[model samples]
Target: MLRYYGVDLLDLHRGTLSARRVLVLIRHLPRDSALVRALHGEEADWGAVEHLLAAVVDHLAIGNWLFTSAHGDSEPPRPEPVPRPGDAREEETAATPSPRELAAFFGGL
Candidate 1:
């Protein structure tokens, strides 16, 4: 599929196109079924193609660094905790501070 887009699959495979880069490239993929078939030929299983495409997109969303060069530097993204429905009110309360905020406040001391 990368070849169909005139992108060298070898380059991507060689890590020249980082996982982050593949995601940017995949966003440009043609979404129509007919176009997909045309590119992959008659053997293209729409479901499988869709699944692989989705997997690539998912990896990109997760910020995989597989494509990065040995010299490339990426700061780890700060994670945000998922809020539980049961803690909704506590989450909103000004009296309660999040772990991050509390850490920041005490760390200065």
Candidate 2:
């Protein structure tokens, strides 16, 4: 979530990302954001970006799915991430965000 959302998982794990500014960053990812550009724009390094960000792309998909399901809102269709060779399915999400910290995310509002 760093590139697009500007809040790293580490911050979330540390119970920091829910701060008002950070939550604003995460919730306000614009359509023309850099992550969207890399995903849909004429990216030059399919090989490198795919290898480096394959997991990130998957997480984006999952996050989008979760958001849509939770809110019951249909977002605009976006292209699926390119499948990686062998599809490294190692354990991701090592540092799940603290629910208690997230509780404060909305409190600042």
Candidate 3:
């Protein structure tokens, strides 16, 4: 399954839209995988990049169902809490999307 690594949005000037670069990483692909050809960007706009990332995240979450039998589990493992920076006590829940949402997301694709 694909995992969310992180995204970095960079530009020459802060808060400016000119010459921005968006780099995204989703784990599990080999270094020489042809999938990189589709994901690599040269001068793509922010909106398109954001949409692609969203679609990818949704796809991975839903695609896990295909391997449920092999895993011998009906439910996926619960995600661990992500600690917030500068606040040791603060944590964020990483909830998996509902089945209905996954259905809709895949249907649209």
Candidate 4:
């Protein structure tokens, strides 16, 4: 695609490509205005009809997917956390001695 734009592949990877240099390459395009419009997702100029579709495909390929909820119908709902009941109430009702009481009881023993 860069070659199609008359751009050097090495320049793009080297990060040495200047904005003006890229513009110069784009100017070589037969339909510069139409390429710009396609990149921006707008209607292309009549003169650029042949290459406008390809430009749109190229630009849109860089975007992330945007899908509706219905598209992923198989996804399961997230589960809520459940807390376990503590044993404090059961121990108290059963006359089980507290830690302090048990310590004193054992110390006396």
Candidate 5:
């Protein structure tokens, strides 16, 4: 009896996954556009759902599941380095840009 994130792999393998069961599993997942649609019962393909579960399982096996955010941002979070007692370099804080700078940045794209 294999289980991935508390969902029984037997249900997937047996092709007996129900909408209610899918709803329960999806609710525990991170909030995103596709998930929002699923929550509203907009998408209803059992095979696609099964494929999604398989993909998640594969990702988990590779230990890169949390590397991407719900919004699909590939940039991983960086940990801040701890300064030593006698460090010569000072840590520079990130400055908040003005609205004009923000507009210009997005406008360039």
Candidate 6:
């Protein structure tokens, strides 16, 4: 639909939508969608923002299942460990820049 890929996608990409609004839209977006692919690309990782949003989404889903589906009688599932940047197991591990490189990139020591 135009609303999904056009208007809502633009608002999300521009950060013009609220966190909750963005989350809802993001949930409905297929992983193959352009917006999802762009936001979650290897060349353009928004590190902390991505992690926090993922945690919120995961916890929300778990909470909903626990409360509504399980009738508040079951213990919630344990949270998944946060992903480490540059982990050796990653599909594309990142190398830490040297001090000199960092200084050069930052324009100072």
Task: Assess the local accuracy of residue 31 in candidate 1 as a C-alpha lDDT between 0 and 100.
Answer: 44
Q: Pick the candidate with the highest lDDT.
A: 6
TM-score, prediction 5: 0.20
- The Cα error of candidate 4 at residue 3, in Å, is 4.0
TM-score for each of the candidates: 0.25, 0.27, 0.24, 0.25, 0.20, 0.27
TM-score ranking, high to low: 6, 2, 1, 4, 3, 5
User: Model 6 residue 98 lDDT?
Assistant: 76
Question: Measured by C-alpha RMSD in angstroms, how accurate is candidate 2?
Answer: 20.9
The superposed Cα distance between candidate 2 and the true structure at residue 109, in angstroms, equals 60
What is the number of residue pairs that collide in model 6? Answer: 0
TM-score of 4: 0.25
Ranking by lDDT: 6, 2, 1, 4, 5, 3
Query: What are the RMSDs of all candidates, in order?
Result: 21.0, 20.9, 18.1, 22.9, 19.0, 15.5
Give the number of the best model, judged by TM-score: 6
Over 4 Å off, model 3:
1-46, 77-109
Q: lDDT tens digits, residues 23-56, model 4?
A: 7767666534557656643333444453566556
The better-scoring model by lDDT among 1 and 6 is 6
Residue pairs of candidate 3 with colliding backbone atoms = none
Model 6 sits at a Cα RMSD from the real structure of 15.5
* Candidate with better TM-score, 3 vs 4: 4
Q: Which digits, one per residue and each the tens of the lDDT, describe model 3 over residues 1-107?
A: 12332322332245533332322233444334455435653222234555677667666755665467458656766433322223334333345677888989899
Which residue pairs come into collision in candidate 2? none
**To one decimal, what is the Cα RMSD in angstroms of model 1 from the true structure?**
21.0
Q: What would the per-residue lDDT of candidate 1 be over residues 64-89, giving only the tens digit for each residue? A: 44444333587555333333223356
Checking candidate 5 for backbone clashes, the offending pairs are none
